[model samples]
Target: MSHWLPASPCTPPGCAVHAGPARRPVPAAALLLAGCALTLAGVLCAPLALSLTGGARRERLVRCWAHAVLRVFGVGVRITGPPAVRGGAAGGRAGTPGVLVVANHVSWLDIPLVAAVCPGRMLAKSDIRRWPVLGPLAALGGTLFVERERLRSLPATVRSLASALHGGARVVVFPEGSTWCGRGPGGRFRPAAFQAAIDAGAAVQPLRIRYLGGPPDHRAPAGAAAFVGDDPLAASLWRVVRAAGLTAEIRVLAPIPAGAVPGRRELARLAQSTVASDSANLPAASVHH
Candidate 1:
């Protein structure tokens, strides 16, 4: 929960576990903005192309751009688990057309991390849809917005997610409903999104995001990577940008088949338990650092 950024990078610089360098705030911020500009300019073509490209071309377009953004920002991603078997490297289908990637919400970086693996439609907070520039890009990519404050809108949002899955697009949802420090098992997995997977007969893939703490060679930091509470986006962004040596690990657990789980509530419980157990069993952050 502490927002202190590490001051040094671990030795043996090439190690993926090592967060390469100590970030210089001014340079990192400029770089972050540059990356955003590049991404926006590149993806701006998606809207026009979406209408003409009849295949996975549009997805690939946004995907390639996402990879570029993550690389420019110094975040690395690793995905582990069984393959989707049919769709692609990150897809897992249980006699269904698409995959419902359910991950624990941490910082906004989770988006590029996952996309660095493969492209997928994301379910974002309603406010994201109103952002100045990024909002339009997301709309072109078919992002679904959840009005967390409007209870009556839940059913419609779930239905939209189901439709996306049924249409063969990997749909990523952060069911925690908000961000947390991630030191403990994440907040409860709200069951609303589970219904989307169930209705679409899609396999549910549980993902865990662990923020790397400590200098690669020194002690792990006291708190885990999380962007929670009242931290402004600008502040969180600057913190990450300045922490050059900071890194996060993504673990993809076994996927749950469509029919294997009954009822939305039950599915939510199983998924939550699996993620919670994994987070609990993770070796203390200090040991790994």
Candidate 2:
């Protein structure tokens, strides 16, 4: 592994604890099957959806699908913060900038949860392009793949991201570069993605996601949904479905406008601090800006 590639120390044994009994194995199995069916549906319909729908309509479609997926897996969602700004709103306005959505990485569930609020082009590792089923679906959804291992490719990746934002496209990124166990602030927000926002003069929207209701012994209940270290995707999925009362609470912090801070490092710090605010209490959601 490249030294630059973000790695988390969280492992299933250390971080993930048994949240509860399966309750109903048959229901859990059915839900997992439904989730799979939905994913396959996306793969089959996405190309046509891309061709026929406008950005706004498509965003609504994606959001609804994401919500459905979460519901199927019995994960409830609670969102606190200002309502998400719809994408492509500034399409004809030359100077108006786009929004860059950033959040803490926890589980595969994070993907749909983020989409449930702000639908956009996701920044994913280049390896996702080779994954079965998901790879083609991601491409159809306009995901931007980054070659993180090759430091030489950073500039080109930034340029692509900038171009997308300049064209008034909302982009979602996990600035931590890896998933943590969701105990405290998992990892620092890397400054590279912030550079794209600065170059495009875009706004940054930071969201903090926490998983509620896990094993009482665990410090962070969010670990129940965490997919970190060597945790297999199948194991993570099974855990999420079997766990009882797993609610994903998303807190949307105030958005940092274009040119709010002088540099990417400062911009990244400001956003991370905003997301990390009130970590101890996990206080009520309120819009920061």
Candidate 3:
């Protein structure tokens, strides 16, 4: 595993190479047009979403908005595995329930793309709830905001998240806590939210998102489309809109059951290992032992 510490954009199988931060040029016209379209689309949909009465209707509208924004942003999504399944890992007489979906975080775009594909409420940092116009829309669309900075609120947050999962909401969380400047895995997964799955007796779905297609300048040590460091949202969004045909490759790994009462640390390690392997950032033989 150490031999492949710096994987190179999956150039060969079983790589764990670091492609490094991306440098892309922002096309002025494309950025302006795409930005305006996305803003207008959000403005048009927010009130309509607010006007809608039912959760199902609102969720559908959000999904539609996700698709439209992808078009406006020139991003395409390709999902690679079966949706998270309930029930025993093998074919059996047991039944399946809602899942606690976990993934590695890379960009702000991760939000809408994940929402579009998963079609469920997502866990966002508390700061997002105060964003200008997007905050209310996200809350209305069923986003569950967690205050990670406060050490005291953790238990309640886990309980709240567990309750949501138990109630059959497919809750998505990025346990890496923050974004990085590589297509490879970032930091380790925090175990707190994994405990929610354990509490809810739900299966843990491990997924990974890899970016594809960027302008020539952006394709450096590897073709990484990361929104990391001090990049402002507008700058990151500008990079996205400027790159036509950019794709977010969402890969779903095999689900890990929360039964047997394995500790949350084990679950987090397993999920992170699975994501690294499936994402081609680590060799399959490199079990997180």
Candidate 4:
């Protein structure tokens, strides 16, 4: 609701519950074990859903599992802009093709956060496709896997993404290549995703995700992985929710018309600049991904 960025690295005083070097309200080992259990369940159930039903029903199940994971972590989302389209209708375009929704990368949490809110297929790195439990669930979620180093695979990846969009499925992509804290200016967004959008002649919807307020004890420091490994998931998430209530602003800027932007590079720059500028004004704990 509020957009002010709070001062970072501030120690909250007089809060007896959180007052010590070890401020984790929940034990880290237990939280991780729960996460692992949830992930395993998701992986096991996904295939059954896919085999029994096709199309929208399966997508809905994926979304449900994603939300379940988020809930297990005690995260709540506050979305701005129109409700995400169900059954890949492109925000209500009927049989018309769906738009390509591109966002910035923030943390590992971005996967569930975006998946829970947006109903669509995600283009993720190949490594995520190979993760033990999470990878299988993501695959069953209809994620498109891409190889970052294999340029030869780029055309096929683009075509696959385009086909999904053309088939009335919104494709979500993190064009920033990897996650960042979103503390300063945003990271450089890769142009490949924009290229996919252009190839499909689909409009590009730029989404800026800002995670406002995190646990006082969690040290987000610098580096990308710190946000995930430096703090316990449940404790960190609860701290954020207690302070900011898992509040996030999903700003859907005006869609850029297909072919209006000269090239993928230019389009990428435009979208990156838009998100970076908007997110810069959000809370410090807030990150755009």
* Number of the top TM-score candidate: 2
The lDDT leader among the candidates is 2
Candidate 1 lDDT score relative to the true structure: 0.66
lDDT of 3 at 2: 24
Clashing pairs in 4: 5-283, 104-289
Tell me the tens digit of each residue's lDDT in model 4 across 1-289. 1111112221122110222123244554444566668879878877777689766665566667777776555445556766544434534556766778888765666777776667678888787787677788878778999877677787788889888877777899888665555455655777877887787777777787755434545422222111332344444444432332243445666667778788989998988887777666544443322
Order by lDDT, highest first: 2, 1, 3, 4
Itemize residue pairs with steric clashes in candidate 1.
Answer: 84-91, 84-92, 214-221
Q: In model 3, which runs have C-alpha deviations exceeding 4 angstroms?
A: 1-61, 86-97, 214-224, 281-289
lDDT of 4: 0.62
Reference-based TM-score of each model:
0.80, 0.90, 0.75, 0.73
What digit string (tens of lDDT, one per residue) describes model 2 on residues 1-289?
A: 5423887777788777655545488888888888888888989999888799876787789989988889888888888988865434423354566789999988888988998988889999897788766788888888999888898888888898888888888899999998877776567898988999999888898998888774545433545788888788888888888877788878877888889999999999998988887365653232111
Clashing pairs in 3: 6-17, 6-18, 7-16, 7-17, 7-18, 86-96, 87-96
lDDT per residue as tens, model 1, 119-179 = 6788987887876666787777778887776677878988998888887778888887776
lDDT of 3 by residue, 1-289 (tens): 2211222232212222223333245453565577556756676567666676465565566667776666666666777888655332122233444678888877777777776666666788787788655676577657888766667777888998888777767788888777654444567788888888998888887888767664445532123346665555565565565555567777778888768448898999998988877756432222122
Q: Kindly provide the TM-score of model 4 when superposed on the true structure, using C-alpha atoms.
A: 0.73
Query: Worst ten-residue run, lDDT, model 3?
Result: 3-12
Query: lDDT for every model?
Result: 0.66, 0.80, 0.65, 0.62
- Candidate 4 regions exceeding 4 Å error are 1-28, 51-60, 85-95, 214-249, 285-289
Cα misplacement distance, residue 161 of candidate 2 (Å): 0.6
